[model samples]
Target chain A: MITLDHCHKYFHKGSVNEVYALNDICLQIREGDFITVIGSNGAGKSTLLNCIAGSFFPDSGTITINNHDVTKWPEYKRARFIARVFQDPLLGTCPSATIEQNLALAIKRGKRRGLGKGVKNSERDIFREKLGHLHLGLEERLLDRVGLLSGGQRQALTMLMATMIKPEVLLLDEHIAALDPKTANQILGLTSDIVGEQHLTTMMITHNMKHAIAFGNRLIMLHQGRIILDVDGTEKSKLTVDDLLQRFYTVQGEELSMDSMLLT
Target chain B: MTLYAALGAVEQGLVYGIMVIGVYLTFRILDFPDLTVDGSLPLGAAISAVAITGGINPYLSLVLAMGGGFCAGVATAVLNTKFKILHLLASILTMIALYSINIRIMGGPNIALLGTPTVFDAVSVLGVPPYLAGVVVFALFAILVAVIIIWFLSTELGQAILATGDNPQMITSLGVNTHTIIILGVGLSNALVALSGALVAQNQGAADVGMGIGTIIAGLASVIIGETVFGTASIARAFFAALLGSILYRLAIALALGVEFGHFSFNPSDLNLITALLVVSALIMPNIKKRLMQR
Candidate 1:
């Protein structure tokens, strides 16, 4: 379980550039819940994910994960239970590392890494099996550097890495936004497969309205650092891109702009 | 260059190979512009020289010198990671501070080891000529260090260090404490550098504070030249390239020192000029080759 209470985060506090990145936020993430988060630019979607990932501490709040108060925890400390996939493909994996080496690192996530061989002989078959599922011919190229792969392949690999250790919380921040439409759909399929197989508790931030509506069991929309619309189960299953836009228009009235809403 | 001069250059190259490997770890692998090596090199020389002068075993003094260099590296790492200082500025600060610390350790600007027993003397009982013995010992040390470093980099701990340099955020997200990795990586690099410095002091039969000035530049030049000439296809290859690069660099310097143009022979004072030219050529050679290939 992940919980955020009275979360208030301000950037450049007291300065002319001061803006509330997160405002009096209150949220509860149930176990095994796959939540899709949607928001416009500066809508606090990334900030919420960053806070939960322990990238930075919330200015004022209580963030608890699995009943442990992790508000004061550093990113590496929280990484034991949390995994993140960034929007930029380059941000997700080390380009200089080999494919097998990258997988080895992910396998050791939330565990102690010592002086052992990084890509153990025993893990080779497992890595090969996992990469085979991607159908990108990466299974045969385990020794190839991650930099040699295309951006879409990197994102797919990143998704696999995020769930390698069955993380307690998997945060995907616009992970597929950088890929082509076909690649994006393929990665989305892989994401669904991994999340299902592992039963992962996930929070995915996406700009595409269709993906936000299609993927997760629950949906939340953020507007100016506050959750404006939240729906789940039957209500979320019935939601359409137009309905979501209309909801936003009702909330912000004249401030709602189509440019901020990305359509597929 | 004479045959004897060429042999001497190879020996010096082997000793400095260790230092170039150290530079490669920080400048290339860790992506850190560390000037700490400038001071740590002399600090190692001072520590080894003082210990040897005090009747300690020369080999034991090398270990002590390495320890001193490790501590100096940790100081720089702390200044950058903990204090949130820019890495370049932090290393520069450590380098400047080490200048005073090195002098205090040596009790003077220089220490001559004339008539003092050294590691070379200890190894001379093999009945080999002095020049050949120096070459054999330094070569073995260089190869051993290269092998060990290559093996370590293939390990989990070493991969974490590479990842920390490649992308700190990604490594940190994978639950690796990047600050700790940075500290250990930089520390390990400086330790090797110091070991090289200790050997240098023994080879020269003296240690001087100014011996480390521009040491980082020399190391960088060797590394760049190695990558440009030999290529860095793999970690092991890169290691060998660094060693080979150092030897080639020394040979180039030795040959350049003897060059004459229109009755103006190159002076020993032109060492820096030679190094600068070598580095520039190395940097531009690949692009030149590519252009030539297009034609």
Candidate 2:
């Protein structure tokens, strides 16, 4: 579970160009709760995820994870409890390293680094078995350079990597936004399956309202750096993208016609 | 034409190969085109030679050499990462800075501890013959450093640094603190390069500030040659290729020197030209193979 209380984040604070990215946000997420966040460009959805992932420190707030006060923990120290996937496929892995090497790194994230053999023989079989979940034939290519992979393959591999160790919380920042539509669906399906299998508490920021409505037990809408709409369980399932868009307009007092989110 | 001469080539190549590995870390692994290698090489030699001359322990001298190079690498990284200076430009600034630092470390334009205890002194103490000592030192350092590199980059923090080079956003997203990783990578890289310089100074009996000139080119030549020769597959192979490329490059240089044995009484000054030609040949070899394969 994660909680953000009275969170405030400002970019370029005290400067003429300063903009508030997040304002007075309060949210509590329960264990195994899959929350999909929908927002337009600059809706501050990504900003909220960043704060939880410890990429940004909230200007004013307390963040608690699993009953621990983690508002002040630096990123590396906090990595043991969190896992994330980026939108850019290339951003997820070292392109020049072997698959096993990459997996070894993901397997060891947030641990003390030292000199020694990187991958043990036992870990190799473990990696192969895990690679089976992706269905990408990557198991046999454990020694191949990750650079040779297609974007979809890499994203799938990254998603698997992010959830490999099952951190306390999983943050997805428009992870499938860069993939082609077909690959996007496949990855989305994989995400649902993996989250269900592990019962991971997940927060996925999405521009696609359909995906926001279609996946997860809960949906939240953000506008102007504030969460304005929250729906869950039966109510979430009953709502369509049209209904969600209509609600955004009704609650925010503005037309929900952001082309970027709608087009997505 | 004989085994002795070939072994000599291997020794010389192996010594410079350490620089190649350092280059590999920055240029290949970290995905930064750092030209600071040119200056760090001599900076290592200068620090080691000066310390050895000042009666420092040989082991400590190597550490100081590594430290010197670490400083240079840090300067480059700080400039690049913090100041928003471009990578190439940042390296240039560090390289320039190191020139003066090396001079300051030496307390002169150059210094030689030709008869001092160096990285090679341990080998001689072990009763190895002087001529063979170079190769022994090279092999020992190569294995030790290679082991350290392979292990260091595999750890969770190390792996995150690797990920930093691959994708900074992921590292940031993962809370890896990319600025710290950048500094660490540079520090680790140039430390190896400086160690190479210390060994070189000990082998040759002195260090000159000018010794670092063209060092980056030589390291790149070795790396490209290694990639062409071994076809990079893993971290282990990338390292082995660096060593192999160094030996092969040395042999080519030796060949060039040998070719003019009698036709011209070539002096040591010819080394620069010979090195340049060998680099050109190595650069062309892979393209030639690719072209032939197409045919």
Candidate 3:
């Protein structure tokens, strides 16, 4: 579980170009809660996730993961409870390293690393078994450099790496946005399977409304550093995109103007 | 070249090979363009020479020299990671500061080890010919260093260092303090470089304040040449490549200095020029071969 209370993050404070990225934010994520987050550019969806991820501390307020206060924890220090997959495929995996080596890194996530052999002979079978689950034939290329893999394959591998060691929280930030539609669908399907199998507490940011609505148990819409909509369970399942747009109009008192969000 | 000259070149190669491997660890593995070696190498020499002249055991002096280099490297890493100095600038700062430190350590600009006992003395007692003593000892140490490096790179900590260089963000998300990894990596790299410097000072029987001048350039040349010639398809192969590259680089320098063309000869002053040319050719050779193959 994760909790954020009255958090605020401002960029370029006191400067003419100042902007509030996260403002007066409070959130609580329950164990095994898969929450899908939706927002347009500059809506603070990423800022909210980043605050929880400890990329930077909030200007005000506290964050707790499973009851331990982590407001001031650095990103690496908090990584014990969190795993993240970036939008750019290259950002998630070490390209020059072999597939097994990358997986080996994941296996020791949030754990002390010593001078022992990184990839044991016995671990090869485990890695192969896990890679086989991706259905990408990566197991056969265990020794191959990750850079040689396509963007889709790499993203899929990243997702597997993130969940293999079982983090308390998993953050997916537009992870499949850059892939082809066919690959995007494949990754999305994989995401669903993995989340369901592990019952992972996940927060996935997506530009696609259909995905945001279709995947998670809960959905929250962010608008200008505020949570404008939160829907879950039956209400979320019964609601349509039109309902979401009308709700946005009613809540913000204006028509939704983000064309990319509308188009997606 | 004559056999003695060739042997001398090989001896120099083995001694400097340790420095080349250190360069590979930082520039290639850690992705830190550390200029600290320029100072740390001489720092090691200064410490070893001073300690040796003060009646300390030669082998223990090498350890002291490595420890000195480690501190210098840690200083550079801290300046970069903690103080937020640019990595290149931080290393340069350490290097410049070491110029003063090395002199203070030796209490002079140079220390002569002409009659003092050295590590090679122990090897000489093993019945090796006097001329071959340096070569045998240096070869044994070089191979030992290469083996240790190869083993270290396969370890869990080594993998973390590789990941830190490859993708700091990814490694951080995996729960690694990249700052700590960098500090350890850079420290180890400079330690080996200092070890090389100490051995070189003993082999040639003198430690000069300026001995570390052009150290980084030569180490980099050896690394690039090793990668180019040996192909870094694997970590073990890369280490061996670096060692052999150092040897090849020294041999090339010796050959250049020995040859004459139409009454023209390369002066010893042309060492840096020769190193630059060697690195350039090694770097471009791969691309040229690729193009030729395409044709």
Candidate 4:
């Protein structure tokens, strides 16, 4: 349940190298909607997510999360209602911390943290139960440093961490792009299971077009800081990459470039 | 080593090793280069000495001395966290301020703490031998501090402080207020240093305003030697390594004073030189070790 109206974002505003990151964009997300975002580099896929995550303030827009204005909130303050998993696995976790400590921090995401004896036996049990579902054996290695983990395991752990308290919205900024294909697929499967289990409203940005088509009920193609096509339900199910290419041509009125779009 | 030499060196090492623990907390644990130790060490000594001369119990005076160092740390933390001063600048400001503050606290250049009811006085209160006081005091406090620190590092806030050093951004995203953690870590670290300073002043029977001139370097030397000797992969081993390193460093210095009488005078001035040489040796120890390993 999030909405953005007439959002505008500029980089280095009033300077020579000024660029428009988001321009007059409008988007709405329903509760439990899994939206896939696909675009070329500099297409504002990340800026859009950044805008939603309170990383950047829109120059002109009203953002409402579950009907409360959050446009002016700071990143730390917005973190109360939102959880994000970065593209890099390392970005989502403290490498030197044990799995249980990191999970404990995530569990108390919006609260004051202090020197309490951390992760009681019951909390450890809960984290292990959640980690067990990932099937990566992180649950068994709860005392191990997260730095020792493989990228895939870390990503899965981050996913588990992000939804530990089930924030109002989940932002996945190409959460699996850096992993090898098999690990990426595994993380994606974990993502689906997590989203389904938590009923989280999610926006996932990906460079891979097949994942864009296959993962979500709703798909939006962003080109030049604007949504070019918004398809969903059966229309999205029937759509192939070829059909998506033709639609991008019709919508943006430009031949599809960026080889990544066709190769995948 | 002779009995006198071993006892003297080990006692001094144990006292200064507490300073090393303080340095480890900020430089290694909190990742803050708090220069406040340069002033806080002498500040603790001065405060404890003055308090002891003022008819206060030496054990209580030592605690007050630690509190003085904690204040210095808190002031630095506040400047950096609340006033937005850069870390190095904040510590410089506090270190500079403490110089004036210590002069005012002692009301003079120095004070003596002998026969002043120090923590070691209790052993003699029970009619223990005079030579055993330093050993008794050192063992009790060093062991106590080590256990507390190990327990604290296992805590939630302590882990967050560790995480803050590794990546503040990740912790902040998880809603950790890193500034608070830094303040707590620095306060705790310098408190340990000041406690060491208090004991050193009492053991030496006097506190001079300049006793802390190379305190940070000495602490760094101990920590570096510890890490090089025992490795830094695990937390518990690192603490034990630091303890062993401090003892080793003191023994080496004692040996140098004993055998190198022709090369250099074993005076107070030589301490700075010795510390500088120890640091250089420590810096080169790792590379030398790696080269030796390759063979």
Q: What is the TM-score of chain A alone in each candidate?
A: 0.95, 0.93, 0.94, 0.93
Deviation (Å) of B92 in candidate 2: 3.5
Give candidate 1's whole-model lDDT.
0.92
Error of 1 at A208 (Å): 1.8
Tens-place lDDT digits, model 3, residues A1-264? 899999998999999989998888888899988999997789999999888999999999999998999999999999999999999999999998999999999999999999999898988999999999999999999999999999999999999999979989999999999999999999999999999999999999999988888889999999888888888889889878888777767755554445546878
Can you write out model 2's per-residue Cα lDDT over B4-47, one digit (the tens) per residue? Answer: 88889898788888888888899888899888988898988988
Q: Can you tell me which runs of candidate 2 are displaced by over 4 Å?
A: A6-24, A57-74, A135-141, A180-182, A248-264, B1-9, B57-60, B78-85, B114-131, B154-158, B171-175, B254-292
CAPRI quality level assigned to candidate 4 from its DockQ score: medium
Question: CA lDDT of A107 in candidate 4?
Answer: 89
Q: For each candidate, what is the lDDT?
A: 0.92, 0.84, 0.93, 0.85
Residue lDDT tens for model 1, A1-264:
999999999999999999999998999999898999998899999999999999999999899998999999999999998999999999998898999999998898867878899899999999999999999999999999999999999999998888888888999999988889999899999999999888899999999999899988999999999998889999999999999999877777645455466441
RMSD to the hidden true structure, all candidates: 3.3, 4.7, 3.1, 4.4
Candidate order by DockQ, highest to lowest? 3, 1, 4, 2
Docking class of 3: high
Please identify model 3 stretches exceeding 4 Å from their true place: A249-264
lDDT of 1 at A133: 91
lDDT of 3 by residue, B1-295 (tens): 9999999999999999999999999999999999999999999999999999999999999999999999999999999999999999999999999999999999999999989999999888989999999999999999999999889888999999999999999999999999999999999999999999999999889999999999999999999888888889988999999999999999999999999999899999999999999989998999999999998
- Model 1 CAPRI quality: medium
Worst 10-residue lDDT window for candidate 1 chain A reads A255-264
- Give the DockQ (2 decimals) of all models: 0.78, 0.35, 0.86, 0.53
